[model samples]
Target: MTLKAYRTHFYKELEAFYPQEEYETFFKVLAQEYLKLAAYEIPLNFQLELDEAQRNLFDKALSRLQQNEPLQYIVASTEFYGFPFQLSPAVLIPRPETEELVDWIYTDFKNTSCTILDIGTGSGAIAVSLAKLLPEAKVTAIDVSEDALKIAEANASSNAVNVQFIKQDILDCQALDRSYDVIVSNPPYVRDLEKVEIKANVLNYEPHLALFVEDQNALIFYKKIAELAIQALQPNGILYFEINQYLSVETVGLLKNIGFSQVELRDDFAGKPRMIKAQH
Candidate 1:
């Protein structure tokens, strides 16, 4: 079938399930990946004919999209902080706000040598990016999920950066094995009460273990990490987190109560209070 004909059929089938713009985007992404055609070129290639393999790929992708699987998962990859990362149901897809968190750290420590740890480093997005950006810095990342760690380690290797990956459940640790010049995490901060606000793609496909906390104990990870950071950070070392926007005030207070000094909350580009940094 011709590209234009399939594009029309694709839209017609998914128009009820997704926004017009999004289905168009899905087409564009598939075109790039399966057709090896740029978005600009797609318009010029309406008459292009699809081979059997291309047709089957697009057909299967459309079926998955209808079920609300994330496009990144369908593609099995995503771009984080300008670096490509592999993704799966085992890891939470990296978000733009987390990119901001990485940028904030990079801006502060790009010129210096340091030790860094990324707690719950799903996909190793932050750890790998930092290692690539600050070649002088030593980066280590830990997660409790072995499957997630496998993806994270592959990301580090593919990105050609050296990062140490460890399987660790931070909440059970009595103390960190070694001190770090900087500690960062984008831990489970979504309260159970907030699940109603999550989209189906996220709620259904992403790893909940990396995404949720009980409403009654929403600050569990923050408190535990802060307690460990108190002992694990070098003097004046920094800690950063991609935080739950609604709990910014409580998160800041938690750090201060735990003896972390100079706690600062920062917003993402959308002006949500989505990140925090503190010093020990």
Candidate 2:
């Protein structure tokens, strides 16, 4: 098939299941991945061989796409903080807000030899990115799931950075017998009640353990991480969070109640108050 023909067919099929905007972009992304997988042969750009083997691969990708699986998850990799990261169902796909969180932290401590811990460090994006940017700093990442840690390790290797990866649930994290100069997280803050607002791509494909909190206590992870920082941080150590768009005030309040001073909240590219920074 020609590239034009393939484009039309892919867009039509994708639009049958997803929004027009998403379908259009995903179709282009699909073609790009297919081309890359095929080694980008000049004449065969975006056109599968149509033989059994190529057909099978194409069918599998299309099936997952139709099922609303995120393309990043299907490919098992994503880009964050200008670095490529390996991913899996074990890890939450990186988001732009998380990138912004990393950038803010990187800039805030660019000249310091600080110890940093990224709690709930899915895919190790935040930890590895920080390690790469601040090679002199000590960066440690913690997650409850071993499977997620495996992917995070792979990502750290791919990024060519060293990070301490620990397997521990945030709620039950043991004392590491040390204090950090900065603690950061983009923990699960989405409440079950907000499921209606989540797109099918996210609700169906992303790991819920990294995305959700109980409606009765949507701030659970934020509270727990804040409490930990109160003791785990060195005096004047910083705590940062990428929070739910609707919970800016509540997140700031939680930080203040934990005795974090100079608490500041900032907006994302969309102007939603999505990040909070506080000092212990």
Give the TM-score of each candidate: 0.98, 0.91
- In candidate 2, what residue range of length 10 has the lowest lDDT sum? 37-46
The residue pairs that clash in candidate 2, if any, are: none
- Whole-model Cα lDDT per candidate? 0.95, 0.84
Whose TM-score is greatest here? 1
lDDT of 2 at 21: 89
Q: Give the per-residue lDDT digits (tens) of candidate 1, residues 1-280.
A: 9999999999999999999999999999999889988879998999989999999999999999999999999999999999999999999999988889999999999899999999999899999999999999999999999999999999999999999999989999999999999999999999999999999999999999999999999999999999999899998799999999999999999999999879999999999999999995
TM-score of 1: 0.98
**Model 2 lDDT tens row, 1-280:** 5565656777777777878888776655555565553334534554544555544565688789988888888777778978999888878888898899999998999978999999999899999999999998999999988999999999889888889999888887646457899999989999999999999989887889999999999998888888888888887789999999898998888889888878999999999999999985
Per-candidate alpha-carbon RMSD to the true structure = 1.0, 2.4
- List runs of model 2 lying over 4 Å from the truth: 19-21, 37-50, 174-176
